[model samples]
Target: MSYINPVLPGTNPDPSVCRVGSTFYLATSSFEYFPGVPLYRSDDLVSWEQIGHCFNRESQLDLSDTDTSGGIYAPTLRYHDGTFYLVTTDVGGQGNVLLTAADPAGEWSEPTQLDVPGFDPDLFFDGDTAYLSYAHGPTLAETTIKQATVNPDTGDVGEPSELWRGIEGTFAEAPHLYRVDGTYYLLTAEGGTHLNHMVVAARSDDPTGPFEACPTNPILSHRGHPMQSIKATGHGDLVDAPDGTWWLVFLGIRQQGGHPGWHQLGRETFLAPVEWVDGWPVVNGGELITPRMTVDSLPGDGSAPDRAAPARATLATFDDETLDVAFEHRRNPDESAYSLTEPPGSLTLRGRTESLGDSGATFVGRRQAHFDCRIDTRFTFDPAEGAEAGLALVADERHHYEIGVTRIDGTTVAIVRLRIGDATETVVETPVDGPEHSVRVDATAEEYRLSYLQGDKDYPEAVGTASSKYLSTEVTGNFTGVYIGPYATTGEDATSPASFDYFTYEPTADE
Candidate 1:
């Protein structure tokens, strides 16, 4: 059977996996997005479904004003005894917090804020004793991996002990401790989270060890291999399948357009086979990851595709009381700012003082999973004097493109604007006589085209276009993928509301 590289695609990065009985559960980072820490479950590993978010309730998580790529760092999902534990760092919120649930898909308890003073927290349970491993450093260049014994029931932590500081490269973080065959093995991702990322390992006979680095340090890395499609490969977790097979689930990016390190889909979850050679773990036979891999099939599972394909053609209608799992907000959104049932079949978003460039914007979006795709939405708004409401494609606070309708000089107008670095420019502006309109943004490998439809017009007219490269990670120097969705701002009281009819995303046929 052949499976895809990104078992879970899009912005699903910093993956951590664990097995409970025959089912496998995975968690990934949801930086600056509400309902943080997206969880997925799979019986066959090849075909996965989003189970639920760990931080679903407002009380469970608070990411208010967290900068882009600042909230919900690397998360480690592990099942101990009969309970599921998810430990992670909330960068700009409550520091380190631990969550637990009886069922992986059920509601998780409110976070237990730990005293740990670092990021990328992992929980390893050996019998009744539990250990917490994390990365501590003032900056990425001086980071160090540390560990401490902890009580799972209480948030108390023991004295921190220094562990391996990585054999090569800086930012040696995302540490996972495991006991294999009567020996302790510590795995870490170093060389930063950029093109030079790599995974290295060290082993000892004790949990807190006088560890020895593997002679073949950096056992897995795609660095220096520009021709390879997968780059910046690291931050992996290992799990043993029910069939007694070892698999490595890690984060990697798929570049396009002959670009060596340019990626718009963000870091995605990738899977590869793992084997033990001379008591050391070797991944993918020490080879660069490919887009597809052939593997053994699960015994009775046949829903998996012959090959993994990119996500395409999705429609999100606000028909239910709750938003879909794919929909995400900038940060901790105001509880009173959005509603799905108020208008019945429409998503009503109330404008606020926050703008797209602010930390707490009333914006909802999903990852731009595909490079070549079209995103369109129908919205109706009668804005106040200074209110603005419409759609946006965002890379970060400083880099984004927006198509919005605002009241300018007592007239409702549709405008397309672009923000790059410290400069902001309006690409197109048109008067909208009516209160309702449909806007669309089509993205190619090179540029993005903004268009709209008014009244009963059968075709959308082009409003403006902008270069796509300016909104890329290479240009912005940010660690997030692009998100497309609706937004609203009133510059003050923010009492005006915008009603969205529906949102649709369609990828090009060749994507």
Candidate 2:
């Protein structure tokens, strides 16, 4: 179904959708946020529910010190012979590995290494033999496509085989290979992954072609459309409806606030109908207002919210499973490092040496959803040794906003400031009576003011503020989403416990 905005907002890109019977599952490429890839489920593609994560535990892929925008790239999701599989490139350094599961709801198998070169791999299984479609080298730099036969049963590649390169213009990265009837179709993204992006398709009778471009190339796009809803559209996947109808799911940006182009939600999944006209797929041809389409014959039979997010005032006591859409680390996530079965109700985040600037702490945060939002958290110190919990909007270490909580001589004080590149804003410190303190901040499209509630009382204590000063795609550009997570900078003594009662995100309830 066509969604008003991002059904799952904030920095979710390179979305890979797969249908298992009536159930639909989606996974996105998470660079730097460890646990590698996150898996989501939906009965109706419109309202999505995050079930469980694929890399909930370690052993899937190795992640450590991989900087923001490092590690994983575009990943492919496919269902073959009763098993669900995800194959991806370690764009940070190591190349490829394939992980599988009996069911998307179950614990995925340990990642199986694949001997292949290139990043942004998409998997297509025509039969028992599976094919991985990828753009090696640098997608923009290479402007090429490659394929290899992988045994679905073993998750191993036959050999590294070369496919056709993009001789024609507007045929670059995000290569997806589709076989229709007796012909093979290779769909790709061009003009980069932003505004100028377009979907181009080529075909050949052979899987390894001498492929020919379709007459109506760039089958779908909003290149010069009148509507401001769609821009930077590309990196898509195709799937068949239960009734045999053909549709395509691609990423698009919907501007929020008065800003109509730059997006906080990196790329959202958008759908358009495709009809095979003369052996070629046609996507929203010659249309200025590319309308949002639907798959169901009738809308939901009442009783369900039209994509309503649960009402939230504070982050603690949150019950939506707290899905970490962009949580990844150097090694696989250790369930024990942080326990889901915490003090019965609260989220217990163990103090880890996950360095601040050099690396980062284990974190899971949603993409920034609005021009303004607030983040609040409560954590205690270990008397002699206190931990640092940073509430931030991070693109990387270079550009970030950090408000740290630590113990000074046994009393708790809060320090908040803006740190950009090498410059700095005077760190503001507020004294509190208890060792545990409640911190809150007001962040706007233009301003970010950090303040704390004195001893759980909601009022302005000694405050610190910064003009959303570090907010600029040009200054800290990584085509990424902003996040709110807890960190530990308590030197060594890693055993010091840091329990974040809860972390809250408020996207401006009213004007």
Candidate 3:
């Protein structure tokens, strides 16, 4: 059966997976977004559903003031006995942390800060002995795959020992250790997470390896293939199925536009079949991955009972008892900034004095999973003098394109604003009469079209456009993708709040 490359799409990078019984569980890097380390469960490897986040409470994760792409790094999910352990690095916070849960879908315990000094921590248990391996050093070029004996229950780690520095590559990170039969295979991603990203392997008889590099060192990569649609293919974890088949789940970015084009959806989770050949695992018959591929060894009847449709869409009315798991806040958001019960059926966002250009901004958004998509929202915001509220396509604080309503020069106006780097501009503005307004943003691989409804008219008037490439990681130099949702900001002494009636997101057919 053929399955999509990104089984879990949109901003899900540095994937780590573990299998227990007939089910597979996966986790990925969240990076500066609240409720960090998204978790997923799958019956079939191709179809996954979000169970919950590993760090759902503010007490578990404090992303406040963390730099862009600096909060959560690579997470390794492993299951031992009946307990599940999740270990990861908070690049700009409390360093490495360990958390466990009896149920992956239930609330996880608060973090236990590991005394390790590295990123991408992986936990491996051989019977009762626990081992922790990670890419350690002060910088990428100096990184070495290191392992140490660990007490999983108390988070006490013993002295570390050096493992392999990657073969013919730099930035050795994202290490996962597995004992296949009697050999300990160490898999690590090297050459950074860009065009040169790659997955390399080594093997040793001991967990603290004086190991031998695989003859085919880079078992998986798309390093030199700039023209391929799938880019930055690395950071992989191996999972063994109950059918005795092996698979590798990795992170890759899907490029749009032209050669070495821009990717605005961030790094997504991709899968490939693995076969053991002469004691070493070969990924997808030693070939790079693509968006569509056939996995003959996939489990189940090629059907996912609860899997989302190919073209995913969502319509949220903010009438639910709590926000959907799909929605996330920027940093540790002011909980008081948002309300679903204030005005009964509407989602109210109290404007913060903080602008979208800073952390703690009053913004809640979902990852932009599709290149060709449309977002339509109806909102009412009586801006206090210089306040503004509306929909936004956000890459980061400094890079975003927004269309909303604001009061400028005492006139209530609908405006389209573009913020790239240090330059911010209101590209289009038109006077509107009422507080209630409907806005729309249509996104393609190349650009975003901004429009708004005029009065009681059925059609929307065009309000300029912004280059999607400018919002890409290639230009923004961030580790995240585009997020589209509602936002609001207030000036001093502002009293009014922006209340959103409904939000609709649809992946449209390409033009």
Candidate 4:
């Protein structure tokens, strides 16, 4: 009953796990992935369900014209004192913003920006003083670690002082500071976040001081790839299991080919045991843990190891809402920008701007990765002449591809095109599948292939090489993640508004 693969499927990266009581909560930095800061709750660290999102409205975080990597970056979710704090760096030129809520499942407060200079921030609270530990931008030569006091009331960062810088080019990023048994332990992600990624630790008597690196520097690493289920292991947060055992949860990439960068399987969440031997934390035999078929222990409910269909996975079920976690924005969107209630299950993506480059369309997208996926759309493409209703593999304005029913002339035409940055290349153009018809876009990732669904089957006989290349965190400039979404575009060429009867995304059960 486990997901067996991709629990947080399709570009759910930068996962930060926080266990509130017996309920385990996980949040990922949803760069342009809208409804920013996706929050999922699971009784067990495994089996999870999407309870809500952090940015519920546009006013909180804007996403209009936001390029590929423009939105939110690495976020740290922590339960301090009594409130749940979700801190993130909005690379969208908005600086860093922190939002808080009394309950993880309740309404969250608006984000308060910090004049801070770095990204991927983690907060530490001690008594009345709060410290924010983060390091991203270039260091003073060594890896830079900055520590600053955070205001509890406004979530504003105070004057920051330079903490220790790692000697290696690798900086102390994703730093988590905690005090245990009279010592301040700083747990940080080292070796960068890419290839050499690993969890490193150091301890200091003071919150800010000359720290001593752990003898076992890399407390955890996924370097061993006998079958390499977790790759690029780093950026971790520590937690105490219900049984009182200490553990660390971190994100790692799972690569298929040793060649690297064929198809980024993705950065997945992984947990490892932490042994505190003589004040130094040793993780999984002093090396990163290898992937396992299943976690041995049960989750909070004490359920058996997953006979449940999908653990910690987000399921839309064509429900009342479009599974908020599965959405993103051009610029930040206001509640009025889109609607899930009007047609209920049918997501009506109102057009924000006209041009394809900057227009804010309510594109409910998922990551474009699948050995096989079936996405059927019953959309009414009756908008102004140029408005578009189609499914897209959106990386950015520059790098994107889509096949959809666009209202052309007096009728709807099926258009296929590829856009990489400012330049666009049209794959082909066909007159409609017929007016107001059911069009589906099916993409298979095996050979990095994609195709359009013509009727009940993969459509029009066009299969493009399936590549997750454009979706790479390296190529696409935006901090935002890429998604495969069904979009409705409105421009000056439009006549009336279009509404979709429904859009269903169901990957092959085994995919």
**Which candidate wins on TM-score?**
3
Against the unseen true structure, what C-alpha lDDT does each candidate score?
0.85, 0.64, 0.87, 0.65
Model 3 regions lying over 4 Å from their true place: 303-310, 458-462
Candidate 2 per-residue C-alpha lDDT over 37-118 given as tens digits, one digit per residue, 9 for 90 to 100:
7777766555666666676654565666465677777778888777788887876656777788887777888777777776
lDDT tens readout by residue for model 1, 22-134: 89999999988888898988887766778789998888887775777788999999998899999999997899989999998889999998998989998999887899999
After superposition, which runs of candidate 1 have C-alpha atoms over 4 Å from their true positions?
Answer: 257-261, 298-305, 309-313, 455-461, 491-495
Candidate 4 residue-wise lDDT, 260-335, digit = tens: 5434334666666676899987776565455443444545554554533252222443456544455555555545
Please provide the root mean square deviation of candidate 2 (C-alpha atoms, Å).
Answer: 4.0
Worst 10 residues of 4 by lDDT: 307-316
Higher-scoring candidate on TM-score, 1 or 4: 1
* Among all candidates shown, the one with the greatest lDDT: 3
Model 3, range 1-511, lDDT digits (tens) per residue? 5667777778999999998889999999999998888888887787787888999898998888699989999999998889999999988798988999999999899999999898899999987899988888777787988888899999999999888788864688999999999999999999889988889988999877788999997898898888898889999999998888999999999888897589989999888999999999999998779777776647655553332324546789998987778788878878788899989789899887888997878899989988889999998888888898999989999999999899989999889999999999988888887788899998888899998785666434447798899999998999999999999998863357999999888888731
TM-score of each: 0.94, 0.84, 0.96, 0.85
Between prediction 1 and prediction 2, the one with superior lDDT is: 1
The TM-score ranking, best first, is 3, 1, 4, 2
* Residue 301 CA displacement from its true place in model 2, Å: 6.2
In model 2, where is the ten-residue run with the lowest total lDDT?
A: 294-303
- What shift in Å separates residue 372 of candidate 4 from its native position after superposition? 3.9
